[model samples]
Target: MNKTINDPNSPHSIAAEFGVLGSMLIEEEIAGEVIQLLNKSCFLVPANQVIFEVMTHLYDNNKPLDVIVLQEELRSRGLLDQIGGSEYLFSLVEGVPSAGNVEHYAHVVRDKSILRQLMAAADEIGTLTRSGNMDTEELLDRAEQLIYEVTQKKAVNEPEHIYNLLLNIFADIENSNHSPGLSSGFPDLDNLLSGLKGSTLNILAARPSMGKTSFALNIADNVGVRQSEGVLIFSIEMSKDQLARNMVCARARISPHKLSYGVDEKEYKILTTDASVFAQAPIFIDDTPAISIREIQAKARRFKTKNDIKLIIIDYLQLIEGPKEKKENRQQEISFISRKLKEVARELDIPIIALSQLNRSVDARDDHRPRMSDLRESGALEQDADSILFLYRDEYYNKETTEPGISEVIVAKNRTGPTGSVKLRFIKEYMKFMGISYQKPT
Candidate 1:
């Protein structure tokens, strides 16, 4: 448990700092652990911070860490006399004879550092609020982000032993259903991609009229309704009501056009039944148009904490607003957005499916199928995504083609698995995609 301290200035413990420095000098092996646990800013005492900085420099260069070497390095940098010379170094070693309690001492210093950071962050928020220059909601979001970053700074940097990791893996295998990731609700697609793995950024790209939005909604409904897992959808291109209507029509197998005339008793029952299921499903939708990446990050973090969302789907990457910092070109802006989206997926520890638009170059191609090169605006989308799926319908290009009412999901790139295409039946009237052999029930 962390204790809240009101006084940031008085949070320093001189003895703890000395103990950490002393342990590092006593045992060279302890230096590495100390370096990983705490950095210079963790030491409130100026001399201790200087000493630890020099010690890190020596450790990085594979030099010996002791009084003699440290003194020489400090002297060369003209910080020796300022930090109280050789006596201070000797005193630190004499104060702590053993390195056994070094880790404990390090924790105390780290806790103090966190309290100070929190206090400083509070001060910053107070100043910003007083200035009254920014919008209220934006200021509040920034304030929360500042505090979040400060708290996240305490994450441990220790490396785990391979043996421990293997033990965990073995246990997972024994208790597992052989499905390491969430199912996409399509068996063949699941077999091809091994389901949607967590901590991954998946790119779903296609030209207009390829049913990209419908395909994604199908997966979202499958995961959220069928599997009873939380799903979050950021629909940048469509309204929440619009997405809901499409999903209801797809799941109930009713043509959306028929809704204009009115449905028969059976059709109305199916529609109401499916709508009820959706109402109870743990699916969250945010249709904030022209939303920037920062806003998405903020909202995604909030939803993950509150809902424990297992899947996140962003409707069309091209529609998402880029970073606040102005880029040299549109490609650079897109590259930055792609990298940040990948980071968001890793940070949230969930799979993110970002819909994307393909370049017109695909239309010029004889096959009318999208390649990785056809990703619009930037190649970073290809580089950052763990997997890329292209939606291609033969009937869209040629009405009399033999594969009418069928669509090919081209697995253009799979980072951890084999690449292949999966054919699905596209019910154009209802805006739904199902397995190739699926038949609508009477």
Candidate 2:
């Protein structure tokens, strides 16, 4: 009987009595409810572990927590001591309850901290157990519900439903006014795609020197100048100044090579004045090399906060890095990056224009027209993007061909509209693309 009663593992004894006492203490109306709440929410982990987690979170944020706010929080959990309470909560040290009685309460809290640790350990047993056991759809729904509940609590007085309705109305009004109806950079293309929309991903792909960058820049410049909204261009391949110079030379109808190397006296004056004017345009560029998607999101958010950033341009998608993870192959990395970029666009509620490079298979083909299959490294790019435009300049393929200066803007995948090709005038010297005159392509 003593063995059964005194044994640490015994179901009955002082330790067992303490465990029951501890659980009762946890259940009582006092600050112990915070510990109970934490256990319930995060799972009963060790009290010290929970403390460590909360402290680390606070430390990383570098802010002093308000104890009054914390006390009120405990009160909301129905944990505050009753005026004529019979139960004694562990004594309070400073403002927080003592951690001394946690061992006794372990069983009542179910050693919730230990239970959580066990669950986490069980999670690592195998991939099959971790993933296959859980119904992902149900889990996702539960998670989303929890998030909504928490966020609603935080924004209790914000009138979210009404604000959402107002936001929808504002969005409709803005889109209606800014709608680029049946107007593409090319007349034939306009007949097909109309124009890009808000909150869309448009990928432009090509082999090098196929006017992909030039085409994307042209579109961005047009959107900025014509729409009168600021456009952010993240250039992993080129510097901001270099892109700006290209834009100035293109807009001023001067040769990029001549402007960069040495301009004639008359062209020099025109280029200088044009450069100054273009500098004042609402075009912002960040030329950070090999930037991760997270950095892009942070910078884009800051830009939106500071200025009304309407459009975002990423010069080539493959250059972006995925979240820090060891991937089996480059394909997976590219896939991760593509998905993240799409997510970023959705989060920011802005259109994303990402440039891409086609595989050599496109060059091997007799038609040399870029296809969805030719998207380099990852098919996820095709899956994530709302639209994919392939830039095919015939002049690069066959110099002797009759169609020398024409480029095809092939809409391979467009979620919003029809798929077809738009023809534009590709001026190689100026590194610019212009909509072919409405009259005819002479």
Candidate 3:
């Protein structure tokens, strides 16, 4: 039904609707582009709506478009005379300045249409509230979901040719070394897995005090500082300050105890000067403990849009909570949480590194090495992770071991490449990981 102009609050623009139709008539190529953005109900003028409906029909059925074709079609459907004959259609093509702005004009019409829908939604919600029948929470959820649908409507993608796909693949292959996807800060690791491919869930697992959190923080700092990329760190176990102190220890090569407990003048000077590196780095920390997956997903999405965040690091997976309503089993809940994290990675098109804990079975073994089965909630984490890295430090088990400071990142599961171990030096005092080849000053 056409909205009467007497109602002042009805959201509609007659000029924008006419502009979109006129531009489409003037240029045939842009017809599809503008048509995809709007529909029949987007117009305030009923005649404009009828003209657009007929124009879309002509374009859809392979008919060559012109004023004559449109008039004949409207005449055949008995709408030409009702729409004020060919005179109104002639005026439709007169005022459009450029066909290039058709899509923009269409967007204006669509936005007005959305505003009208919001008005109707508000009325419905008011009616529901007056009746007092629906649950308050359910009503709020439905209202939010309705508004979200309006924002999500967008132009759909057409099929891409194979040549385009080949170009992207070749480009990625050529740029795999240093500037590929978000850098791992390790040349060897970047070469191994192409610097943490986008839309992947990377699991860094180990027993307690194995430096998984430190390793993730180090990677975050590397990407944030070196690449100047936005990084969001969700620290469930450690506070934001603890994370920053640990980061300082790793980046500055200072002792964690001194940075944490107290700092002397010389050490304080070093910490303050070195800490400036992080001041400019685009790193955001959220230290909410036992947060649910839903909340994390919401925050990650908002951050991705606001900051254009390139990487997300959850300190450890075990500390996260599932939905408010408890599930039947703890393992199932853990599986749900990990899967949700994977969705966040894919939706934002970024790499998400989630820390995990290993079962004590690895400690019972004489070798004291962890594997895929040692994942605390075994089945789901292994299944959902695109890559699994098990951290093992020989010094943690045997003090007089052959390689005292070397930590092994056992690539147990890699969807993109070969599975093996990458050696890095883990400094216990600083809570830092360095390349195995890095030498200390004796």
Which one wins on lDDT? Answer: 1
Residue by residue across 230-318, what tens digits does model 3's lDDT show?
Answer: 99999999999988888987787888887547878888888888799888999999999887677687777778767889999997898
The sequence of per-residue lDDT tens digits that candidate 2 reaches over residues 1-442 is 2222122342222333234333333323232434333332232222323332343233234434333432343355454443111122232222234445554444434443333333333334333345665554334433433333332222112223576588887887887854453133444665565556666777888899888888778777776765567789999999988898888887777878785578788988888887676565688899999887767776776676567687888997888866556355788888877886787677556788899988888878798878889989747888899888888888788989787778888888888788887777788878888766523324
Worst 10 residues of 3 by lDDT: 1-10
Please rank every candidate by TM-score, starting with the best.
3, 1, 2
Clashes of 2: 6
- Runs of candidate 2 exceeding 4 Å displacement: 1-191, 438-442
Candidate 1 segments exceeding 4 Å error: 1-142, 146-157, 440-442
- Against the reference, the lDDT scores of all candidates come to 0.87, 0.62, 0.82
The C-alpha TM-scores of every prediction are: 0.71, 0.60, 0.75
Q: Which candidate gets the maximum TM-score versus the true structure?
A: 3
Task: Give the per-residue Cα lDDT of candidate 1 at 368.
Answer: 95
